[model samples]
Target: MSISVVILAAGQGTRMKSTTPKVLHEISGKSMLFHAIDAAKKISDDITVVLYHQAARIQESIEAHYSGIHFHMQDAVQFPGTGGAMKGVHVTHSKALILNGDMPLVTMNALESLMQGDADINMSVIKLDNPSGYGRVVISEGSVVEIVEEKDCKPEQKEIQTVNAGVYCVKKELLESYIPALSNDNAQKEYYLTDIIKMAVDEGKPVHPVIVEEEEFKGVNSKLDLAHAEEILQRRIKTEWMKAGVSMRLPETIYIDSRATFEGECMLENGVSIQGASHIIASHIKTHSVIEDAYIQNSDVGPMGRIRPNTKLINTHIGNFVEVKKSTLTGVKAGHLAYIGDATVEEGSNIGAGVITCNYDGKNKYQTNIGKNVFVGSDTQLVAPVTIEDDVIIAAGSTINKNVAQGELAISRAPMKTIKGFFYKFFGEK
Candidate 1:
């Protein structure tokens, strides 16, 4: 039997209190709907997504990410509810696995098990210690008798541990047959997808309830819930990394994007963070090279380069003993200690300690170009738009604004004045 997945994504999730579609909200920079669709693709190649609110935009996003999945538009009048939305998708006589768009953390294995159940209609159930606000499952003789919503459930039924999880697997024919008979007969006057369970039992159809763990059934309806889900997912990912050979210092404190990759034997020390599609390949790091809070994309950091924390490096190269930040250092180098920003230090330059390229003109940014082998002296501020030619030596504590010629020593300082008798002249009586 072919297993086809149908994802019901029509709900606007008003409880989320945002205009953005709920499924489009990102978890680790990926849309939640994408995660759900990815899970479905593992089991069934035939997939259908039903869309209504923000329909055009959602369709465009899905088309950009996935090519072959089918889209079914929910008609406003004909299909007014989620159950109605599922009814609108006409899959060709396949065992239908229905998924909610809001639950991004549901595992592929759980879905596979639900699909394999192959009951006439199988409800994914989870046991809740306090099933107060949720629907309570009423099972009789090892079969689901009914799922009563909390408001309608009797006091005794409220004590039931098993609760309807809102995910289901059903044979297509039975669903299409009973969907037309569903009525909006509840407190909210909305036709619940759970109503189908009661419909099945009333007709003496076999209803099976498969118990899934509590985590697999969690759904997001609020921002707080979304944060909780992300935390759970991050912890799960960190655990997997530890199981594999990577070492993490204070894994709980690390906030790594799900897409970021690290090679084995790489140590992520406390407060060391990598973000934004940066990849590391088999490199060792010396201690205290804090790459703290950096957005490094498509660049490799040398083992000894001091990428002093809070810097943004993009498409650049960094060499040893270099401190860069609050500036863009692309294709520039300081073979030694140099504050290079808003300035370009050309290749093969030895920048001594106390070398400051003053690229700020108190009005706007300026570029200071230092040619190769230009020995910039200690405590020298090269006022920018200035070029130091090849083999130029700038004197210590000099402010060089004009270009220095090749093999020239340029210096700018006040002329010395002697004051031998000034103290005695001022205090002659003493």
Candidate 2:
């Protein structure tokens, strides 16, 4: 059955207290809205995002990342509420799965479960120990009769532990028919989508309840909520990787981006952060190191190393305090304290400690190429646009600015000078 997805993102999350829209807030390195959209896309291609607050900004941001998304600007001033957000939205399918944009942790499996129930409306509900702030789902005779808002719930209704999850899979016909007739006569003067439940029940339409875990439907309305969601998502990501043969020490301290992938037995130490589209294959990332948008295979990166974007390391060892950016190191070993940026160090090369590739000259950036069997000594600086041919040796403390031919030695250092008895004269026979 084809199902259309409608993500409601019209509310200005005032509790979040930020210039950015509430849905734009990030959890697990992606905006909460994107996470909802991502889960929605898995269930349906016909997706519509309803926006009101910062509608243009939200549309522009989403368009940069996704295509074929239909955005609807809600009339927030006149018809304001969840029901009003769907004023003129069109659904391509007979069934529409409505999701809240702030609920970033909702998974595809949970959404799919709603489709299993054969009813006019399938509403998600969770049994919380304390359903204080959420609307209570009133079930009568094995059917969901209505949802009573927390503010309007009677004393007995307040004890109902089953709360609405704010997610629904409804027939498109019902939405088009009843959404227009919704009234905002309550205390808040906002049209309530929950009212549709009582309306459906009055007409003897089947209103089924799909019970889900509380964690899956967590809504992020504040920074603390965002942090809790991020923690949950991070644990999920890390636990999945661990089950897939990737090991981590002090897993709580390590952070992995959702876009990062691991293959074939990788290990991450304490304080290791892997972000972006990094692919780690059979490698070990040591303590406090950060790997971002890089590829590593059969290598070990520092106790404090940083592998920046566009870098690839194969069978290499990057030691403590080493930072490699936009470079490829093949079968190379740089022990410690090296800055290799915009450079390529080929196989059988050894980059000594304190070595740096001066690949930038304030105005422009350049590359440093070191050929096979090259040895860059400690504290040596390879200036921009420099090349060291095969079997070339760079002496310690030398600053090489020109290219060196095959098997040649390059060094540029001032001669050492000493003044005899200078220390004794300055100390006055001390």
Question: Which candidate leads in TM-score?
Answer: 2
What digit string (tens of lDDT, one per residue) describes model 1 on residues 1-430?
3788888888888988999899898775468888889888888888899999998989999999898889998774665787678665777646788888888888889897787655788888899887778878898898999877788888798889999887888888877887777777756566567778878888888889888988866888889888988888778777876687667777777555566666646565544444445444343333334453344544445434555434555445554455654444433434445566655555445566667777776888787777767777777887888888878888878988799998998888898899998988998857
Badly placed stretches (over 4 Å) of model 1 are 283-430
Worst 10 residues of 2 by lDDT: 140-149
TM-score of each: 0.73, 0.98
Highest lDDT scorer: 2
What lDDT score goes with residue 127 in model 2? Answer: 98
The regions of model 2 sitting more than 4 angstroms off are none
> What are the lDDT figures for the candidates, one per model?
0.73, 0.93
Positional deviation of 143 in candidate 1, in angstroms? 1.8
Q: What is the C-alpha RMSD, rounded to one decimal, of candidate 2?
A: 1.2
lDDT (C-alpha) at residue 98 in model 1: 88
Instruction: Give residue 301's lDDT in candidate 2 (0 to 100).
Output: 97
Model 2 C-alpha lDDT per residue in residues 1-430, reported as the tens digit of each score: 4999999999999999999999999876788999999999898989999999999999999999999999999998998999889888899999999989999999999999988767999999999998888889999877898887788899999999999888999999999998999999987898888889989999999999989998999999999999999999999999999999999999999999988999998999999999988999999999999999999999999999999999999999999999999999999999999999999899999999899999999999999999999999999999989888899999999999999999998887899999999999998896
Error of 1 at 288 (Å): 11
